[model samples]
Target: MSNRVLKILVPIISIILGLFVGAIVMWMSGYDAINGYIALWHGIFGSSYSIGETIRQISPYILAGLAVAFAFRTGLFNIGVEGQLIVGWFAAAYVGMAFELPAFIHLPLALLAAAAAGALWGLIPGILKATLRVHEVIVTIMMNYIALHTVNALITTVSDGSYKIDRIQKTASLRSEFLSNLTDFSTLHYGILIALLMVVVMWFILEKTRTGYELKAVGFNDHASQYAGMNVNKNIVLSMVISGAFAGLGGAMEALGTFGNISKMGGFTGIGFDGIAVALLGANTPLGVIFGATLFGSLKYGANNMPNAAGVPVEIVSIVIALIIFFVASGYIIRVLLNRMNKKKEAK
Candidate 1:
C-alpha cells in the first residue's frame, strides 16, 4: 500500500480497535455497550446545543494540536505549551480588562498580546536548547510550573487578591449572538473561525514557505542542514516560538470566547497534554489535526451522557480514548501487519 493510504488507515484502524475494546469492557461489566454508544452519539449530535458545544470544545483542541504538531515537525518536544497557554490567557485577559480601545484595535491587540506572551514563554526553552544544548523537554517542564505559579500570583495582584479577573470588554469579545441563537444559545463563538484560520496558516507556513523548509530540514538532521547553510539554532528557536504562538491562541479562545474571563486553576487544564495525543493521531499534519480534534472533542463531550442515558460509567470513555492513543502509538505494529498482508496478496 502507498504511504498516504497507510497514513489514513492507521488512525482509522486504531479508533476501531479502541471502540471494539471499549465495547468488550462494557459487556464484561454487565452494561449494554450498544446502548452506551447510542447515548454517546445522541449526546454529541442529538441537539443543536450539543453540536455547538462540541465545536466550541474542538476550537481550542485544534490550536493546541497544531502547537504540538508544529514542534514535532521541527524536532522539538515542547512540553511547555500548557505554560505558554497560561501566560497567554493571563496576558489576553489583562489586556481585555485594562484597556478600553475600539473593537478593532482592542481585539487585535488582545490576540497579539496572547501570541506574544506564548512566544516569549516558548523562547526561553528554545534559547536554552539552541545555545546551551539543554533539553527542551526538561526546560519546558520547568517552565510549566513557573508559568502556573507566576500567572496565579499575577492574577491575584491584578484582581486585588481575587482569584478571578474581570470580564473582557464586549468589543474585544469573540462571542457571537447570532451563532449562539443558531445553536440554541450554546456558548458557541467565533473562535472556531480563528482556529480554522490558524489551521491554514500552519499549513501555509510548513508547506509553502522558506522558513518552513529550513525548519523541516533542521528537524530531519541539524548537522546536514547546517552543512547546507541553514541556521540550525535559529530555526530551532523560531520553530518553538511559532509553536508557542499557536498554543497561546488556544488560551485566547477560552478567555475571549468561551469563558470571557480568567480564573485560578487548582491544576493544569490538560489541553496541552491532550494535544500530544492529537498530534500523534494526526500524523503531525495540519488537516489531519482537525479530524483528530473533532473525534476527541466528540468523545469527551459525549462521555457526559453515558451515565444518565445508559448507566455506563464515564471512566469507560476515558479508557477507550486511552486505548485509542495506545494503538496509535503502536503504529509500527500495524504497519508491519499491513505490509505482511500486502505481501500475501502479491504472492497470491
Candidate 2:
C-alpha cells in the first residue's frame, strides 16, 4: 500500500481490531456484547446533552494529544505532559483568583499564565537534556510526582482547610452560555474553538513552516540534522517548549471551561497519560489527533452508562481502549504486510 493509504488504513484497522477484541472479551465474560455496544452508543449519541459532554471532554484530549505528538515529531518523549499540565492548571487558577482585571484582559492573562507555567516546566528538562544529556523520560516522570505533591501542598496551605481553591472570577472564565444552553447545560464552552484552532495552528507549523521542517529533520536523524547545519540542541528545546505550551492550554481549558477551581490532585490527571495513546493512534498528525480524541471521548462518556444499561462491567470499556492502543503500537505488523505486497508487485 502507498504511504498515504497506509497512514489512513492503519488507524482504521486498529479501531476495528479493538472493537473485535472487546466483543470477544465480553462474550467470554458472559456479557451481552450487542447490548453493551448499544448502551455505549446510546450514551454517546442518544441525547444532545451526551454529545455535548463528549465534545467538552474531547477538547482537552485534543490539546493534550497535540502536546505528545508535537514532542514525538521532534524525537522527544515528553512523558511529563502530565507534570506540565498540572503546573499549568494551578497557574491558570491562581491567576484567575489573584487578579481583578476586565474580562478580556483577565481571561487571556489566566490562560497565558497556564502556557507560561507549562513552558517553564518543560524548559527545565529541555535545558537538562541539552546541557548535560540527562534522560528526559526519567526527569519527566520524577517531575510528575513533584508537580502533584507541590500543587497539593500549595492548595492545602492556601485554602486554610479546604483542599480546593475558590471558584475563579467570571472575568477569567471561558464559559459560554450559548454553548451550555445548546446542550442542556453541559459544560461545553469556547475552549472547543481554541482546541480546533490549535489543530490548525499545529498543522500549519508542522506542514508549512521552516521551523517545523527543522524540527522534523532533527527527529528523523539528529546527526543528519547537525550535519545539515540545524541546531540540534536549540530545536530540542524549542520542541519541548512548544509541546508544553500545548499541554498548558489543555490545563487552561479544564480550569477555565470545565472546572472553575484548583483542587488537590490525589493523583495524576489521566488526560496527559491518555494523550500518549492518542498521539500514537493519531499517527502524529493534527487532524488525526482530533479524530483520536473524539473516539476516546466517546468511550469515556459511554463507560459510565454501560454498567447500568447493559449490565456490562465498565472495565470492558477500558479494555477496548487499551486494545486500540495495543494495535496502534503494533503497527509495524501492517508495514510488513505492505512490504510483502510491494515485493509481489515488483516480482510480477
Candidate 3:
C-alpha cells in the first residue's frame, strides 16, 4: 500500500478498534452496547440542534489542532497553546467590549488582537529556543501557568473584581440569528467558517509556500538547513508565531462566538490538551485534523446521551476516546502489520 493509503487506514482502524473494545466493556458491565451507540448517534445527529452544537464544539478543536500540528511539523512541541489561548481570549474580549465600530471592522479587529496576543506569548518561548538553546516543551509548559494566573488577574482588574466580563456588542459577535433559527436555536456561529479557512491556510502554507519549505526543512534538521543557507532560528521563531496565531484564533471562537465574553478560569479548559490528541489522530496533517476533530466533537457531544438513553455512564465514552488515542499512538505497530500483510500478498 502507498504511504498515503497507510495514513488514511491507520486512523480508520484505530477508531474501529476503539469502538469494538468499548462495546466489550459495556457488555461486561451489563449495558447494551448497541443501544449505547444508537443513543450516541441520536445525540449527534437526531436533531438540528444537535448538529449545530456538534459543529460549534468542533470549531475550536480545528484551530487548536492546527496549532499543535503546525508546531509538530516545524520540530517544536508547543505545550503553551492553552496559555496562548487564554491570553487571546482576554484580548479578543477586551477588544469587543472596549470599542464600538462597524461589524466589518470590529470583528476582524478583535480576531487580529487575539492572534497578536497569542503570537507575542509564543514569541517568548520561540526566541528562547532559538537564541538560548532552551527546550520549547519546558518553557511552554511553564507558560501555561503564567497565562492562567495573569489572565485571571486581568479579568478581575477589568471587571472591577467581578469574575466575568461584559458580553460583546452585536457588531463583534459571531452569532447569526438566521443560523440559530436554522439549527433550532443552538449556539452556532460563523467561527466554523473561520476554522475552515485556517485549515486551508495551513495547507497552503505548508504545502505550497517556500517559507513553509524552510520551516519544515529546519524542523527536519537545523544543521542541514543552516548549511543549505536557511535561517534556522528565524524559521523556528516564525513557526511558533504562526502556531500561536492559530491557537489565538481558537480563543477568539470562544470569545466572539460561543460565549461572547471572558471569565476567570479556575483551572485549565483542556481544549489545548485535547488538541494534542487531535493532532495525533490527524497524523499531523491539515485535512486529517478536520476528520479527527469531527470524530472527537461528535463523540464528546454524543456521550451526553448515553446515561439517559442507554443507562451507560459518560465515562465510558472517555475510555473509548483514550483507547483510540492509544491505538493512534501505537501506529508503528499498525504500520508493521500492514507491511507484513503486503509481504504475504507478494509471496502469493
Candidate 4:
C-alpha cells in the first residue's frame, strides 16, 4: 500500500483490533461484550443530551490534542501539559470570577489570561531546554507538580480556605441559553466553537505559513536549520509556548464552559495526559486530531454507562482505549505488512 493509504488503513485497523481485543478481554472476564458495547453506544449518542455531552468533552480534547501535536511537530515532547493546563485554568477562573464586565470583554480576557499563564509555564521549560541544555521532559514533569500545588494554594487562598473557587461571573461564562435549549439542557457550551476555530487556526498556521516551515525545519533537524540561518533555539522555545497556549485554552474551556469553577484535585486532571494518546492516534495533524478526539470522547462518555447498564466494569472501556493506543503506537507493524504486500504486488 502507498504511504497515504497506509496512513488511513493503519488507524482503522488498529481501532478494529482494539475493539476486537476488548471483546476478547470482556469474554474472558465473564462480561457481555455485545451488551456492553451497545450500552456504550447509546450512552454516548442515543440522546440529544448524550450527544451534547460528547461534544462538550471533545472540545477540550481537541485543544489538548493540538497541544501535543504541535509539540511533536516541533520535535519536542511536552509531558507537562497538565501543569500548563492547571495554571491556565486558574488564571482563566481568576479573571472570570474577579471581573464583572460585558461578556464580549470578560470572556476573551479570561481566555487570554489562560493562554498567557500557560505560555509562561511552558516558556520556563523552553528557556531551560534552549539555554541550559536541560531536558524538557524533566522540567515539564517537575513543572506539572509545581503548577498543581501552586494552583491549589492560590485557589484555596482565593476561596478563603475552601477547596473550590466560586462560580465564574455570568458575563464570563461560555454557556448560552440557546445552546442549552438546543441540546436539551445539556452542559454543552459555546466553547465548542472556540475549539473548532482553534483547529482551523492550527491547520492554517502549520500548513500555510513561513513560521510553520521554520518550526518544522527545526524539528526535522535543529542543527541544519541553525546552519541555514534559522533560530533553532528560538523555535524550540516558541513551539513549547505555543503548545502550552493550546493546552491552556483547553483548560479555559473546561473552566468557563463546562465546570464553571476551579475545584481541588487530589491527582492530576488526566485530560492533558490523554492528549498524548490523542496526538499519537491523530497522526499529529489537525484533521486527524478531530477524529481521534471523537473516538476518545465517545469512549470516555460511554464508559460511564457500561457498569450501570451492561453489568460490566467501567475499566473495560479504558482497556479498549489503551488497546487502541497500543496499536496506533505500534504502527510500524502495520507499515511493514503494507510494505510486504506492496513487494508481493511488484513481484507479481
Q: Clashes in model 1: which pairs? A: none
TM-score of each: 0.98, 0.96, 0.98, 0.98
The whole-model lDDT of each prediction reads 0.93, 0.91, 0.94, 0.92
- Could you give candidate 1's per-residue lDDT for residues 1-348 as a string of tens digits? 999999999999999999999999999999999999999999899999999999999998898899999999999988888988888888888898889999999999999999999999999999999999999999999999999999999989999999899999998899999999999999999999999999999999999999998999999999999999999999999999999999999899988999999999888888888888998999999999999999998999999999999999999999999999999999999999999999999999
Candidate 2 lDDT score relative to the true structure: 0.91
Off by over 4 Å in 2: 338-348
Residue 334 miss distance in model 3 (angstroms) = 0.7
Across 131-226, the per-residue lDDT of candidate 4 in tens digits comes to 998999999999999999999999899999999999999999999888788889999999989988989988888889999999999999999999
What digit string (tens of lDDT, one per residue) describes model 2 on residues 1-348?
678888988889899999999999999999999999999999898888898888999988998999999999889999999988888899999899878999989999998999998998899888899889998898888988988899899888778878899989999999999999999888988988999999998989989999999999999999999999999999989988999999998899889889998999879989989999889989989999999999998899888789999999999999999999999888999768767988899999
Off by over 4 Å in 1: none
Better of 2 and 3 by lDDT: 3
